[model samples]
Target: MSVFVASLAFGVISASVLAIASIGFTLQFAVTNVLNLAYAAVMTASAYVAYEVNQAGVVVWVSALVGAAVGATMSYLLNRVVYTPFQRRKASPITLVIVSLGMTLIIEFGTQAFVGGTNVSYTMANGPTLGVGSFVFTGAELGIVAVAVATMVAVHVLIRYTRLGKAMRAAAANRDLARVCGIRTARVVTVTWILSGAVCGLAGVVFGMNAGSFGATSTDIFVVLILAAVFLGGPGEPYGAMVGALVIGLGTEVSAAFIQPDYKDVIAFVILLVMLVARPTGLLGART
Candidate 1:
């Protein structure tokens, strides 16, 4: 029972990270209709950016914020310089997906060339351990959960109460109609990428903190879990992503505890496959 509880605790932590990344991914898809396979690449790049700042004697948390900024900038450029141009030419969705894959190879290899193939851990302490009931967490782990909660609340407010939120929803629903209705859809799409990228960057930092080390390819495999969460909650649905994250996080950790740790990712992949077959639209995704 203690072991199960411990796994559950870890699951919550993993879910927190997954939620941040998956939400960003879903938002991008919702607004831009782009299935960006390079999202993980952006995350890896942002984490490396944070690593550089941290190595320069800056605090890790502050360095993470810097990473978020870099992520926003990179995502903006990706859309403006690459994706936007292709979109203007009326590129097919599959072509865009391939392009994103190409970008993923480029970014991942570029980072590897710069950082080498060595795995590097952050130069930060986890601080004191805290226990709640049967669950134990370090200060850094608790901080991650707090950050996830705050991000979720902020996202809720952004989507529910803000003018930008409304415009984003309008654009997602019907870009042409939203444009006809005088919403600057292009601007909304740009903002979506920036906001999502910021979240993606933070998620990458937290992910490294959780694992205690990372490499250029760290986020590459993690993207599978992100996709599982996103698709399980229904692609393009932010709220669904959250639910999916919780489910997948708990499921994978608990399974890892009872089964082979090496197969944890396989568990998530199985769930994703089952979900796709059972309901391709996902739990919250509306049927067309």
Candidate 2:
């Protein structure tokens, strides 16, 4: 029972991190119409930035913020430098996807060049564990959950109540229509990249925190799960992504209590396959 409950607790934490990363991924795809394979690379780069900041004696939270800044900047630059140029040339979505894959390789190798393919640990101070019944969490884990929830709420409010949010939705639904409606789609796209990239960085930091250590390929490996959640929830649906993350996160961890730990990722892959076969549009995704 304790093991089960512990798995549940860990699942919730994993879900939160997954939610953060998945949301960013969905947002990028929604607004840009590009399946950004490089998003994982962006996360890894941000993790390294956070590591360097932490090594410089900065607090963990502050380092995470710095990582977010770096992510935002990198995302924006990539759009302007790589994506935009190709877009101007009327590149197909498939072409864009291929380009993103190329970017992923470049970023991954670039990270390897600088970090030397070695694992690095963050200097985080441990705190007391908090438990309720059989479930337990550390201070950092609780903080990750809190931040994830807060970020979700903020995103919801922005989308539902703000002008920019509406523009984002409009842009996502139909970019040409949004422009015809007098929306500055260019500006909207820029903001989407920045916001999504910020979340990407935050997720990367929390992911590293949860794992205690990471390497250049750490985020790339995790991207498989993130991609599963994104596809499971609906590619461009943020709320759907959240639900999918929760389901995948809990399912993977809880299943481990009965099966081998190494098979956990297999569960996510199976779920993703089932979802695809049952409903390719996803549980909460809208058909275009």
Candidate 3:
């Protein structure tokens, strides 16, 4: 029972992080129609920024903000300087993907060079543990969960209530139409980059802080987590990403509890495959 409950808690925390990062990824995909493999590098990059900012007595929230700022700036610059030129040249999808892959290599190794190959941790521990049901967790877990939830809610309210959010949705759904309607799509895309970058970076930093030490490689396969959840939930569907994350997180943990702990990470792929087989659109994803 302890293991079961603990797994549940672990799963929720994992889902929270996954949800936050994947939402950003999905947003980028939705607006640009790009499958940027370099997204994970953005994660490493932002987390490293937070690491540097920590010297100034920065807390998680500030670290998150800094990480997000770096992410947003980098994302926007990449789009403007790299992606935009290539896109205007009518680059093939495969070529764009390759470019992103190249960017990934550059960012990853760059982080290793800049931040060192050594693993680094932000906060040794988060907050105090609280017993909820049969599970327990450090304050970091709770804080991360709260952050994820708040971010999601804020996103939801923005989308549902604000004119800006509606314009963003319109741009994502049909960019050509949006541009025709005077949406100033370039500006909208700029904001999307910032929002998504921040979310991804902040999530990476928080995740690293919670788990202790992490390195650039730690940011690598995590792209799979974000992609799986984002695609599973439906690309660009914020609520769907949240659901997909919870499912994947819980499934990974439960599988580990029942099967081999060593294979915990494998569970994500299994679920991804199963979901693809059942509903190619993903649980919450719309057909592109």
Candidate 4:
């Protein structure tokens, strides 16, 4: 029972980080209608930025801030310079996905060329571990979870309360209608990119802190897992993403307790497949 509890806590912690990353990815997809394959590269890029900031004697939170800034900026730039132009040319969904894949490869290879193909660690500014029942977590881990929950709440509030958020939803629902409604669809799209980027960066930093260290491949795999969670939860459903990520995180960790740790990934993926088979639209997605 203790082991079970331990696994459950671990799963929640994992879900927390995954939620941040997937939320960003899902938000971008919701607004832009593109499943960005290059998102992992952005996460890795932000993690490296955080590492460099920490190495320069900045605090961990400061590093995270810097990372978030980079992510937000990068996403804006990508949209302004690449996607926007492609969109102007009336790119199709498949074309956007392919373009994102190309972007992903370029970013990954660029990182490898610049940073070298190697793993790096960002040790959590060492602190005491807190335990609840059989679950153990460090101050840094809890901080990560807090940040995720806070970000999600913030997003919910923004969408529910703010004018800008309403504009974003309008654009997502129907770009032409949003434009007709004078919602500034282009600007909203830009804001969506920036917001998505910042969360992605935060996700990268928090996950790096939580897991100790990672290389490009590790981060990329994590991004893929996040995408799966987002898809399972329903791409445009923010709260649904949280639920799906939590389910995947728990399923993976608990399964790992009895099976080879390596198979844990397979378990999460299998669940995603099963979910897709049962409901093609996703747990909370529209049937469109």
Off by over 4 Å in 2: none
lDDT of 4: 0.85
The C-alpha lDDT values of all candidates are 0.90, 0.90, 0.82, 0.85
Considering only N, C-alpha and C atoms within 3 Å, which residue pairs clash in candidate 3?
68-198, 127-139, 233-284, 233-285, 234-285
Q: Candidate 3: deviation at residue 1, Å? A: 4.5
- RMSD per candidate (Å) reads 1.2, 1.2, 1.6, 1.4
Model 4: per-residue lDDT, tens digit, 1-288?
Answer: 466778888898899999999889888888877788888888888888898888888888889999999889888888888788888899997898899888888877887787788888874565778877666788887888889889899989988899988888888899899999888888888889999999988888888887788776567678778878998998887877888899899999989888999999899999999999998788989976
lDDT of 2 by residue, 1-288 (tens): 478888988899999999989998898889978788899899989989999999999988899999889889889988999999999999999999999999998998899899997899889886778886766678888888988898889889988899999999999999999999999999999999999998888888888888889998888668889889999998899998899999899989999999999999999989989988888898798765
Candidate 4: segments with Cα more than 4 A from true spot: none
TM-score, one value per model: 0.97, 0.97, 0.95, 0.96
Alpha-carbon deviation at 91 in model 3, angstroms: 1.2
Q: What tens-digit string does per-residue lDDT give for candidate 3 at 189-229?
A: 87887787777787778767766778987878788888888
Model 1 segments more than 4 A misplaced: none
